[model samples]
Target chain A: MLMMGAVGLAIARIRDLFAVSMLSGIFSLIGAAAYVVLDAVDVAFTEAAVGAGISTVLMLGTLALTTRKEKLGGGKSKSTTAFLVVAVTGAVLVYGTFDMPRYGDKIAAIHHHVVPRYIEKSGEEVGMPNIVTSVLASYRSFDTLGEVFVIFTAATGVLAILGRARRRREDEEADEGGSDTKGAAS
Target chain B: MMHRKVVLRVVSKFLIPPILLFALYVQFHGDFGPGGGFQAGVIFGSGFILYAILFGVETVKRVLPPWSTRLLLVVGVLTYGLTGVAGLILGGNYLDYNVLAHDPLHGQHYGILIVELGVGITVAASMITIFNVFAGQSGGD
Candidate 1:
């Protein structure tokens, strides 16, 4: 927990974009560690890859194209409404946690019913030891498909942005030489 | 930028392959472990992101062209969608492995392999695509 707070502070305080990105990666790894400690190995793996790995690259890439330092002095005043809303939401969540299930409680709804069957029989049924895998690939295959599409959509969006820019660059270069040569020849 | 260190480059060269290999392992070993398509995809994507980080976007683009990545994105979706479609044609519900082959176990093996491959491809490409957008932004320093 201390490490997580420290990582958050490092991210907020660092002026360098690269350093900020690396710090965010550290924050993500911390989250992954938390998930692992919670016994959610699948979630831990996802957080490690997405949070620490891909997210860092994406953020750094954005930094490469933009200013590293934030605009120091030009932003509008903070909105009190936004602050109050966020505070209220956080408080509500904290309050709601009083009703939450304690960790490792055998009576928790999440640990019982069809899930337990999957956990116990996945090894024999799916011929695999990973209950998470069996549940995701076999019991909830549709969600897996949806996730793949989500990635596909994101990839397409990026390609469209880059493609438009490349085309503009080519057009500019073509006109640059043509206009100069025509002016000279004429 | 030129004055910046090349430490990322050397590190990426070594890190990218292992990251990818680990992704593959997670994908295939999931049935016997605690991972599957989503985890594998993210791990695979991270490897490409590492390449982008170390070598820079230009080098990463050269290695995996935007067009190829786009193709992969489409292919991954198609592979998964088609597997489900195959099950439907075989007189079963969507993604039902029982109809994929004479033996249910054999069909499951085939289905899992195909779906995991799809997940890996989509993940690797999407991650790189996100990185491309970030790198394409207007200011590095």
Candidate 2:
């Protein structure tokens, strides 16, 4: 956790987008390790795969197509307002955590609610050893279904925008795409 | 230039199959483990993305054409929605697994497996398609 926090700080302070992206991947790997410590292996698996693996590759792919260094701003910065907003939001969020149950508190409301029924009866009812899968697939599947469509919708949006990019690339290829590809390859 | 890098090509060739196989294992074995469709899908999609990185996008396009990714995306959703419809047609509530088999227990098993597979398919297709969109254009947009 401390390493993750240090990586986060480095990412925030870095001006180079390429280095920042790399640090974020490191941060995610550390976060995945933390999740494993917390016994959320499924979440850890996801964080490690999506954050450390695919997103890092995609970010590098993007960096290949763009400037590595961030362009310095010429206008006056809004540091005061941004700092104030961050401080206020951070304080309020910390305050909000005060009312929450202590970590792993047995008396937590969530443990009292539908959890017991799932824990006690899920084996007999669903006949599955992995309650998480049973919950995600069979019990609250409507919710998971919605989540899948949400991903599908996001993909649709990306395709629509990038398809235009492809067309523009094709048109440019008619002119000087050869030179561009040659430059990138070398 | 990338083709000259023989180590990347050889290593990725060695690694890709195992990664893809692990994704399938995660998808099917989630009923007894700490993995499920989402994680499995990302792993599987990244397998191809790794191929693209090592071999380039054109090679990957030959393997997974754009139309096929789009079709897979739709087919995933269709499989999921149709599973629910199957339950309803079998005289249960929407997404209810009780009527899917001879007993409710086995029904839940089949229901979970099928639905997780649907999620896996859609997610894998979505990730691959999205990555291709971002990486396909060599020229910056």
RMSD to the true structure for each prediction, in A, is 3.5, 5.2
* Residue A61 lDDT, candidate 2, scale 0-100: 76
User: TM-score of A-chain in each prediction?
Assistant: 0.83, 0.86
Off by over 4 Å in 1: A9-18, A73-81, A169-186, B1-16, B52-63, B132-141
DockQ of 1: 0.55
Q: Which stretches of candidate 2 lie over 4 Å from their true place?
A: A73-77, A168-186, B139-141
For every candidate, the chain B TM-score is 0.86, 0.95
Q: DockQ of all candidates, in order?
A: 0.55, 0.71
TM-score of each: 0.83, 0.92
Q: Which digits, one per residue and each the tens of the lDDT, describe model 1 over residues A3-50? A: 999888787666787788888999999999999988888898888877
Error (Å) of candidate 2 at residue B44 is 0.8
Q: Write the per-residue lDDT of candidate 2 for residues B1-141, one digit (tens) a residue.
A: 675989888988999999999999999889898898899999999999999878878899999999999999999888888999999999999999999998999998888888888899999999899888888765344
